[model samples]
Target: MDSDIFRHGGNTTCDIKQFTIITDKEMRNSMEYDVIIIGGGQAGLAMGFSLKQKNIHFVILDENEQTGMSWRKRYDSLHLFTPRSYSQLHGFHLKGDPNGFPEKNEIAAYLNAFKIKNDLPIIHQEKVIKLTQNEKQKFLVATPNKTHKAKQVVIATGAFYNPFVPNVHDGTANFEIHASQYRNPSQIPNGNVLIIGAGNTGVQIAAELSKTHQVTLSQSKPMKSIPQNIAGRSIFWWLETFRIGRAKPNSFIGKILREREPLIGNDYKTVQNNVEIVGRLSEIKEGKAYFNNGITKQVQNVIWATGYRNDYSWIQIDGVLSNQGRPLHSFGVTNVAGLYFIGLSWQRKRSSALIYGVSDDAKYIAQKIQQHEMK
Candidate 1:
């Protein structure tokens, strides 16, 4: 008899089969599938659609309790940097003005509806803890309570994982929150705010908070600013019209563009007049932030928009990730035979991580999986 323990809802655990229910036995037995995707975000859902088109039996394992939790958990005032036309998955158009940008909630709702409309099979609240390949070349994906066996696995967890906050803040701020955990200005204190990292998220939040509070933005490096609209059309239109959006990462144009990501919005302009911009944050001592340029500010609250790092530690497979824990693959195909990754920034082109670009990678990956099975 197998001595494996059965766990249910993270509360009950039992090793004796007599004490465990029939469903527990079923849970103990690994659910076999042809393909297993380790995320349920837009990338995973998009891959599901492609796999479904090819009649592949696959399942999306989502850590969240419901679909679109990733988007729903973002800042309340968040909006897509790309327009609706460029914010859609395969086969379904995001409703409303194609030229207009969608709100975070709208994107979340659309993702949920997309999963329902496509009838994609997803197992929610099953966060994959460990992924290892057996001698038979079958992947054993272990969650807290269940283990799934799949012939192939796709990691669509996207680029964001653990929030990356530097050691600049020495626990002196009255209150601090990462941009990932920030909701709105109301959630912040009424005093002056210091936002570290001048990325799009940092700039947008600084602009928003400048309306209600004194704000200072900390810039780590010089960020190129581009207008949201150029010549009365979205900048994306111009990029697409000139084929700049499709530039491969290895190309000269792609190399130049990737050198410094240009901020795509007028929010920087909006904040320039109201918010005080400073250089890199050197450190925080006694709730006072010292800049590298010998400037200091007394801030009541701090928001770290320092971005995220992809944590591939859960993926125990060798030769799939680089020394820095980034996926090492040509586009999405990894060196490992049955392993693949999607939704990585600059995975194939400039738009590989964007909503509109994932379908292309998904279709390609689904075809690759089909071909592998056929062989």
Candidate 2:
């Protein structure tokens, strides 16, 4: 990376005095740009594609070695909940079965193709470790080696960062894994498998594995599961028709959207096949799991498909995050000037964080930066 190839211009004279390497914001060499996007996922690509359309001088920095590693890292059996018709980014249609859900690798390939189609300038392996405002009022994107400067910044890092790996004592079950680690039914040790969290992922995985091994899905509360399609049309058609997917987070409809997540894609609820539905798992002890309904199961494998929490600890700015460590932003705009966030759940609407909604948020942000620069 050019950032790693520094100008041998800074103080290099050998001295008797010992000095620690300076990584302070004030000391690093900064590369200037109109905008800097921190992530390389769907959100970042969307924003980059939009900004490119506006002729904005910007760069998207991703930590991973590959542009689509985000999706490639997910469970093998996973596919998007939205059909191909509604799962596309702005520039290109997500290729595949238009009415069917795209597999995880398919989505990743689509994103990578989007990056290429839009000719986005994304620096892979440039993981942003810290972000702060420089004395010049520009945002500083700090990587391990160098700090890049930007007039405006977009935190397009997707919402799902830290996977919620659950800890339970099964007295050394054959094996235990989080849903993120699960690939197929064969990966689980030979025996009954207990899948936690009856949300979309848990339900779908359980249904798939049940065909081979005995599977039980346990959940505390019932999640809202909507049919993938109503009649012959896809559910997305209805969502767009009613504009329910575009509801604001603070709106009544948005509240329900955020809370329930409204499981879709699979018909696990109606026809569970070999899957067993159980009540909340209350305790894990003595090599057994006790349920709230007094049902006990001695399972060989436990799949914690619970969920994930967002961690923005690397960002060092006041007012950008609340005490709970959640970003405070309206749509993609943050309280800190020139700093914005994208791909957050309900960032602008119910679908803002999804593959399709990312385009709208990115376009809005691009427009905002253009107007700001024009002023």
What are the runs in model 1 whose C-alpha is more than 4 Å off?
A: 1-30
Overall lDDT per candidate, in order of appearance: 0.85, 0.78
Candidate 2 accuracy as TM-score: 0.87
TM-score of each: 0.91, 0.87
* Model 1 whole-model lDDT (C-alpha atoms): 0.85
Candidate 2, after superposition: displacement of residue 225 in Å? 2.0
lDDT of 2 by residue, 121-229 (tens): 7788888999988688888888998888888999988888887866655456667777888888778878888888988888888878877888888987876677888
Model 1: per-residue lDDT, tens digit, 248-325? 999999999898898988898988889999999999999899999999888899999999998889898899888888
lDDT of 2: 0.78
Residue 7 local lDDT, model 2: 17
